[model samples]
Target: MMRLVASDIDGTILGHDGRISARTVRAFQACADAGVEVVFVTGRPPRWLYPLREQLGHSGTVICSNGAVLWDLAEDRLLSARAIGLEAVLEARRLIKQLCPDALFAAETVAGFHLEPGFIENPTSELLAEFTPAPLHETLTAEDAVVKFLAVTHSGTPDAFLAQVQPVVAHLVETTHSAPRTALLEMSAPGVNKAVTLAAYAASLGIEAADVVAFGDMPNDIEMLRWAGHGYAMASGHPEALTAAGYQAPHFDDDGVAQVIEARLAEEKLGA
Candidate 1:
């Protein structure tokens, strides 16, 4: 039996309007009523998760920054945070500057976002928390270790930018993105992807991968979908996610996540 549901935030649950639908909320509430845990696994930062906690009725865990941080939503406290050391940050910054000179950068710490003024926000993207803007040098050397680093370029396609940056920094960090079309690149600590983190958390609860179902719609979600026992990609998801997942759901705007969850709940009810 599927005991857990791990889902991505932006493209999987949040609609193009940038809000979670009532149908999605009801589906999750149903999961909770059934004693099935629903966890959010996403590339979003901790600061972006509080609103979701309210939507999900303040239940479950949230793996944010592509798995670099885990928040126990029920308790309203942090569970764990994985950070990239300054050395790695310095190395990554060096490579990013070398490969994409015009790239803008930001870092998501456990506290909040620290960004340079150059990093533009997608109009459709979630409104960011108050940010600390610093010079490139200070931004790279910020006191606290960062959970994830972000890079944006106006020059080329995201895939092309990633192709140029990956080989240089792969050894130092894990690389992926929730928005590939925007030429955004997200770097997390080495070995910290949604799959590894979610699997670890599930194992802690005596649940195995086979007992979990995950959903996603971006390249950042690739490892997560691959790691779950049953993974569903949104029909309107990125092409790479479609290739990575075994099943597909409807679009986020159409309440795809709720549809799938309701179906699974029906099956469980019949089985019972």
Candidate 2:
């Protein structure tokens, strides 16, 4: 019943170590070989996605930055993108100077992340290992654009900052709690999400939303999975993600995504 398939990287397709398993790669290869349009959707920046693209070995498309950018994997280029207007964006740097003076702001661009020295220490740097950055002044008047801006406090109390800023920025942006210690504020742009990206692809191929299967395991993945014809939540996923999904896969460590794909491919063969 499904022709188009989309998957979230983190807990859905990528392993706990932030890599896709050989088994999972082969499974997705079979799907691509079977003419299923496989799309990798993630909240990661494009630079981080380059390594994943090589690892997946699939010649399809990618929806990066949680759909802020659409990349063409086969062509090795960006096809479409939606970046936050720096003018309308939350002044996380300004907020840091006022509320948490010791807090450091890191901005993600198409190139990589940039921040002031001593901004990212051991624990925080380890979490965002790939997005190391340069520094920003009161106003970052640069050529490259910023995808996302993050505030990492030296005090390790992200909630303290969120409590003070979320209400103030609520009217101007969209906020997501990726982790209790990490708050992501995505600029508002209607119809910009993994679901929308996949949906548009499905429509272009004459495949309705009813003929698609999707999988995910994060709060950022909610819309993507729910938009699929057969949506699944990883067993090791968050409670909110499980509630939003139609069924449960095994777990990332258990190769749940590969199992689901194999089963569906078998069903498709049988139907054929």
Candidate 3:
């Protein structure tokens, strides 16, 4: 029987309008009542998780920064982080710059969001206020841990950007992009994708891959989807994710995750 539900947030459970549907909420509640764990695995940084915490109305463990950090929602603290070193960060930046001169850079540290002045294109007044503007090197201190490294360009789609940069930085760091349209890439320490961290967490709980169900809608979710025994790619997911997952569910907006969970719960009840 499945004992855990691991899901990506942005395009899997949270709608584009920034709302979690009532049906999704009910399905999660049912999981909680049935003693199954629900973990949100996403490329979002910890600071971006507050709104989701409010919407969910409960706290638990969240795998954040595409599994670079493990967060405790109840305490609003980081349990652990597999951060990128300063040398790696700087080296990756240097290598990418050689290829794309105009590539903008940003870093999500344990402290907060730090960015190059133009990292975010057309920033709103609020965003401009939230991000600390500085050179990437100046933003981090020797003691600071870099959770995720972000880079973006105005030249091509995200896929194209990844194709160009991945080969260059493959030796330095792990790279992936969640946004299909934007020319942005998110990087973490080598071998620190969603699946690696999720597997560790599940092992700690004595749950095997065969007892876990996962969901996602992007390239970043590929590893996790492939690792889970029953991985569901959203019908409207990216082509890579659809190919990685063993099964497909309805689109996120159509309550695909809830539909799958509810069906499994019914099956469990019937079998019991």
User: Using lDDT as the measure, which candidate wins?
Assistant: 3
Q: Where does model 3 exceed 4 Å of error? A: none
Query: Is 2 or 3 the stronger prediction by lDDT?
Result: 3
For 8-52, candidate 3 gives per-residue lDDT tens digits of 998898876888888998999899999999899999988888656
* Clash numbers, per candidate: 0, 5, 0
lDDT of each: 0.84, 0.70, 0.91
Error in Å for residue 29 of model 2: 1.4
Write one digit per residue (lDDT tens) for candidate 2, span 28-81.
889878988887878776666755667876666788777777877778787877
Better of 1 and 2 by TM-score: 1
How do all models score by TM-score? 0.92, 0.81, 0.97
Candidate 3, lDDT over the whole model = 0.91
Question: Model 3: which ten-residue window has the lowest total lDDT?
Answer: 123-132
